[model samples]
Target: MQDRIEITVTDGVADVRLVRSDKMNALDAAMFKAIEEAGEQLRNDPSVRVAVLSGEGKAFCAGLDMANFAAMAEGGKSSEHKGGAKAVPKTLAERTHGIANQPQYAGWMWRELPMPVIAAVHGVALGGGLQVCLGADIRYAAPGTRLSVMEIKWGLVPDMAGTQLMRHLLRDDVVRELSYSGRIFTAEEALTMGLVTAVVEDPYEHAMTLARQIAGRNPDAIRANKRMFNAANYLSAEDGLMMESVEQDAIIGTPNQIEAVMAELEKRPAHFKD
Candidate 1:
């Protein structure tokens, strides 16, 4: 229903796209709202077993709007909130939404969703755009797609859930190098660096195909697997293994799991319930 963001769901897959192309899908205030709402929609859509995030036009996003940066430089608040007489946007350190604030939530929400979310990145996924892609479970990018952690160039750090996500995805040295330099890198290098799942000539097509494959699987098992995997990332090895056992215990012998086995035995696809 949002204008800046568009969603089209078909056959259990939701394609969520950023539609502002004129400025290469720059992040204006409206975009922030659109992204948040889009994520929320996919999260709640029971029929959506998988989601693909992509941008329309020539680029993914060019990061923050220049005017926003200029205003921040001039001592204006990035968000409009009030505390007594003074208003302040929530800082990055404060995880307003369980490891991210509202702005960062736009990216982080996708990671927390039950189903898989794939980013189909094209030209220029810089700063926040890169952060957005980091939120996805997987990233598919065009070979020449340009990506960077560009906040440093603007005298800002990457405060949009990027730091947390990168900690899991990149090596300590690689993270430090990219964050310090703010240099743009190609999608090919990103794949090698583990920033992308794969490189393709047409990233969107590849993403859709991947999404379809996931959507055809057992939804309940997929959600359980994602939860277990995410839990493993934050817990100790022993505790993570314990948690996986707990998750499996809860799902094993459930109707959907039974359906999954039956479908496999029947040489047909599963029809899992959400």
Candidate 2:
């Protein structure tokens, strides 16, 4: 895990970063498993109220490693191999992480987290890197950041929750055009396409600012909100309203909610537990 990502927890905000600067944080076999392992930890950590995802060096990521394409060119699957042994869950179709397979979960697990996640995107976020950004609740991209749905260039389609996550963020035509062309678009273009929340000079600082704001909120209410918003994606209007009502009812009189009320009444900050 240390070879692939770095995770630090501070003041209820979990800072997660890809650490493979030499390769522009590109996804290789180890990186795929490492991301899944990190996601698993974040999923179970109750102290986390907010999270920020970023890359350590020049780029958020430059898509799949060249070795992955090499494997494809040789008509073999891309997976981890060590000491003449192969990892289990040998295929991409297995549901190894609840609703997603291991590779897909490397990106989708952020969506499954109970708290809000902000991605600080800079440099090139292409292919799988772009899908990882899509998994976040919000994305803050740096000015001039290069992003693309680049699977088409590799004779592929967007399979890493890009189809699932992107529908909520982009128009059908724009998604199709990007997918079809695999063209790298600027951060400004991503803003117009709604693929990013904001294009800022410093995406990391902006993301951290937003994360701290969210971390200050009542954690129970934050979790409740995440649930409601995620549910709204698949539920009908009538059903969505019903689900919202149920979630709101569950949160209205909770201990954390009461703390939020008292803090406001007393003009003091609130402290919440997971």
Candidate 3:
């Protein structure tokens, strides 16, 4: 990975860091590319049972770089890639990765990954940065961290998987309030409003600690749980319950399941299937 982003995988956990501290880890073309690459790499790596994403700077990310905004104001041609080199499908509804195109895939891909992804948020997570965090299965935020759906301030809508993720996390009115007002909120407020998984003094540390715990679990079972939970969001409660039963049945008495039970009974760590 480029210096703009750091990707490290060890002990079945991948830690992906955005390293543009000098720029507050702002989203530029380079950062977008790096994030996309990192997500793809983790997706393809079967050994990675969990992943943590965070920024190495005073902030997580400060949305779009000023230079890009300045160029747009000057009526420069839009540099946004139209799904990269991938050929467009005949109908938008038929695209494979749901509503995501190539640029959006950078954020959406994290959500689609079978294993859990955690976002360690600190300082500020605004616009595109916040959207990226939303893609994660869980968000760990620093106590005083600021978050926002701030695209309205830039005269643009969040185009990086924000809408879809917000829909899953916030009530309709709550989503509208955040998106329409472009207001920034503290981590405490985020926790109260269900925007973050937890508020901590050190988000990255908390996230990694959680990742390690997850890494010690039965990998196959954990992934199956994630899949069922993801499906639950779009399915009726009854249907979701049925799906859960089906998933549980698939894992019961399986090697990983038996290992998990044996580990618990023996007071030892699980030796799970990758």
Candidate 4:
């Protein structure tokens, strides 16, 4: 609902775009709230089967706004929670938002959403920006797009769930080097590190193509797939197999599932209930 972020749903796909062109869609207090709320909207809206996240103007996001660092220099406490949130935590130990704090939720909310979220990344995705991209179920980056774990430059670590996501995607040494150096890397390098799914000329186009295809799928099956993929990272092999069966049981023979079967049998597109 925030002007900084916009959400438009069409054909069961939610297009979430960060619209702060003057700042290259940088993360500020309001931007963080907007991003978190945007994800929540997609999460709660049953009409949305998938989400495609992108940024307007020059970049996906240029990371934390410079004003934040200026505030720190001026002796004001510089943290991710800047606006609206009055009871922000003083430290990481306190849980301000579910399992993650507020800033982390800005990105982590995508993972928490039952449906798949695809990020179409271009321009700069640095520090918090990069972490936001990491939140998606998949990421597509334009060629030469720059990315970094930029918190180190400001004497901070990535507090936006980037570390946990990076551990799953990149090698430990790679994650360490990026976090330690805060060196910007290209989308090609991101793809090589598994940080990005693909590097293309136009990431938004690729992201939309995939998102629409995914949206056309049965919502129950798609949700089940997301559940399995999410559990894959944390659960053991035995538990994962059992969990898969449990999810299958919940989806199998359901109205939508049966519709999918009938559609395939009749050689037609499925008209699934959202």
For model 1, residues 74-158, the per-residue Cα lDDT tens digits are: 6876554221111225344655567567778877888899898989999889998899889999999997999999999988888
Please list the residue runs of candidate 2 whose C-alpha ends up more than 4 Å from where it truly belongs after superposition.
77-79, 82-90
**Residues 1-274, model 4: lDDT tens digits:** 4678999999998889999989999878888778777877787899999989999999999988887778767666655554575222346667777899888887788888999999999999999999998989999999999999999899899999998888989999999999999999999998889999999899998999999999888999999898899889999999999998899899988999999999999999989998
Question: Per-residue CA lDDT of candidate 3, range 127-211, in tens?
Answer: 8889888889999999899999998998878777788888889898999999999999998999998999999988899999999
* Structural similarity to truth (TM-score) of each candidate: 0.92, 0.95, 0.90, 0.95
| Cα error of candidate 2 at position 64, Å | 0.6
Q: Candidate 1 or 4, higher TM-score? A: 4
Q: Order the candidates by lDDT, highest first — what do you get?
A: 4, 2, 1, 3
Candidate 1, lDDT over the whole model: 0.84
Better of 3 and 4 by TM-score: 4
Best lDDT among the predictions, by candidate number = 4
Better of 1 and 2 by lDDT: 2
Per-residue lDDT tens digits for candidate 2, residues 1-274, read 8888999999999999999999999987778878877887888999989999999999999988788778777666556553222332347676767888766776788898888999999999999999988899999999999999999999898878889998888999998999999999999999998999999999999999999889988998888889989988999999998988888888898889999999999999888878
Error of 3 at 157 (Å): 1.4
| Of 1 and 3, the candidate ranking higher by lDDT | 1
